[model samples]
Target chain A: MNKRRAARRRGLAASDDVMWSLMQAAHAVESQLEEALAQVELSGAKLAALTQLVEAGEPVALGELAARCACVRSNITQLVDRLEADKLVRRVDDAADRRSLRAAITPLGRERQAAGAKKVDEVRRKLGKALGAIDHAALKRALSDLD
Target chain B: MNKRRAARRRGLAASDDVMWSLMQAAHAVESQLEEALAQVELSGAKLAALTQLVEAGEPVALGELAARCACVRSNITQLVDRLEADKLVRRVDDAADRRSLRAAITPLGRERQAAGAKKVDEVRRKLGKALGAIDHAALKRALSDLD
Candidate 1:
């Protein structure tokens, strides 16, 4: 907290301060990650989707993609559209569900994802080192609690 | 890491996986905090502003608010505008700098912030306990390095 800003306090609540700190910390982490990702012209959302596809090992239905990403179907559609525009992803009709569409990563998309992954890995190692052997299971549980 | 999702993998990049995990973790934390704040009809942005105002101990200019929140001036303007409409904040022209506006939290705003703070504290404590202790200096250094 900046000293000048500290002077403006009227009736500060402790819990709010804690919450604020958590958010600020999260923001700090995100901004750093975004800057790193910007080098590859990828946003976190785009990277997240690509990562999902890469991890999925095969073509995934668009609706399944949305569910996996914890985002809405419409948002997934828009994301896929952008990815397709970037030539990072392609939409193929689902053979099993004609009503649904499958999104598969293009070769170029995989390459981009690989490069982005390397950069992100560097950032994450730095974060992990900073956070220090973070209890990932605990974090996962807490996150699930939130969902 | 669901097997179903993992089965779709081409060849998971270590860094990409780490980055994705961090983001998912952060998103989980944010969603949890947001849900708690939402109970009082306060979005994360609004709660952040309110928390900053309460912490400031006095009226704060928009620029200062933006700095504390690590957001853009335009975003701060919009957030304050909404906060003012909710009667949670009142804008006062800075006597020293007429061009800048100061936002003061109203009594209602204080109350809401207080309520938000309580819930936030509970969540933080739970999360902190779960995450274990994070090295403040290392984390701050890492965040600053990324910035």
Candidate 2:
């Protein structure tokens, strides 16, 4: 274990330090990712929504999209509206459930998502270089373990 | 090395998967932190600004605050405006540089920062339990090492 981790484990480090470290680290990584996304005219939120639509591989119900995005339905509606305006996504009637509408990725959306994914990977590779393979694996594992 | 990292290292894993994992992890932790901060009527941006002011230990120029927060000066001004409205921070003429204004934390800001810090620690402890001390340390270490 690193000296700092050992100290934390031994209760020698203050709680504030740990919390500050976590926040700083998250913010730093996020900033880098956000900068990269900005080059493609995408914010983190927009990229995340596009990624979700692409992953679904079909039209996703507005409610389902909100749930997956961890946002309110109204917020999803606004987001979808923006995406639709950009021609990156389209709202269509749900064939399986006529009463509902679903958001589907357009070819443009897929293209933008692919571009955004590339940018994200570039940042991750930079992170990997800074963190090394072992630490990178450990971070991913640890984050995945969070509830 | 874990299978995923090994795959990534060998250029075997799809970039989309790696990107998705990173975003998901960051979003999950951020959501938890945001929820905790909400109890104190502070968003993440407000809390970050207040924390920076408190850490400075004296008034900070708007430019410096912008740099520290990784935002533009105008954005910092708006943020400080809200904090000032809330009476958590106050604007003071910079004695060292008469042309500029600086932001200083109020007594209430200190109290709020302390309270917010406490809530952040509580979440960290919960994270520690979920991740275990070792993995938690690794994750923290990895994140710190990122560029």
Candidate 3:
């Protein structure tokens, strides 16, 4: 029984190592991207919000924006306030629900989002070159499966 | 020339899609881990600091800690203050450098670090299961190469 348990522990450790490596890689990539975004007066959070809005192709419910940003509703409100102040996004009354609000990207927001996306692509391209040996198709397949 | 530019744009977009997917995957995994760490009263930043100390196996200078944590010196000071308040870590004058202070983990800190590591491992295991179809060895190789 002790031997069996030891074997199981070893297996778990190996698995943990892989997960740790992935986390480190993600953190490194994010740190680099954050620095890049900062040059444009954008943060990872703001970029994420803008990215969601652009992808949404229309105003999204405030609650849905919060969900997509993986942030609390109050935090999303503050974020939207900043974005609105920058004239990158605007809030509108929900047509279907009079009491609710939605966030839509303004033309300026779209322009900024495009610029941000370009920066992200540049950074990601560098990362891809760095990890060029990896099978990107396989990686994409795996990530898609997770979703 | 226009056709070539359009084709290149298409290629870049496809590449961007793959990169975006990876970012989303990483975000999902990190969010889950952050939630798990919160149950132990540890934010991702604090946990990162603790992990660094544990790995160093000795006291780490405040400036070095800031660099490792990817924050400013003042930020590290505040973070260390919180950790000290919790009695998980302490600050001591650097023996090698009298002008500097170093942060070290206490017995409680070590215990907490172990607990945090366990929680991280558990969450990572779940992520692994979610991406069970991926070639983990290849993924590890790719990430390690990045470093």
TM-score of candidate 3 to 2 decimals: 0.73
RMSD of each: 5.4, 6.4, 8.1
Model 3 CAPRI quality: incorrect
Alpha-carbon shift of residue B56 in model 2 (angstroms): 3.4
- Docking level of model 1: incorrect
Per-candidate TM-score, chain A: 0.80, 0.80, 0.76
DockQ of each: 0.22, 0.23, 0.22
Clashes of each: 15, 0, 0
Q: A74, model 1: CA deviation in Å?
A: 2.3
* Ranking of candidates on lDDT, top first: 3, 2, 1
Compose the digit string of candidate 2's lDDT tens values, residues A1-147.
Answer: 443432232221234343445545655677888899889987777877888888778889999888776678998899999999989999999877887899999999989988987887788777667765654555566656653
Question: What stretches of model 1 exceed 4 Å from their correct place?
Answer: A1-27, A127-147, B1-25, B128-147
Runs of candidate 3 with Cα error greater than 4 angstroms are A1-16, A55-58, A93-98, A124-133, A144-147, B1-16, B55-58, B68-70, B94-99, B124-134
lDDT of 1 by residue, A1-98 (tens): 44224322311233323233334445567787778888998887788789889888898898888887767899999999999999999999877777
Worst 10 residues of 2 chain A by lDDT: A5-14
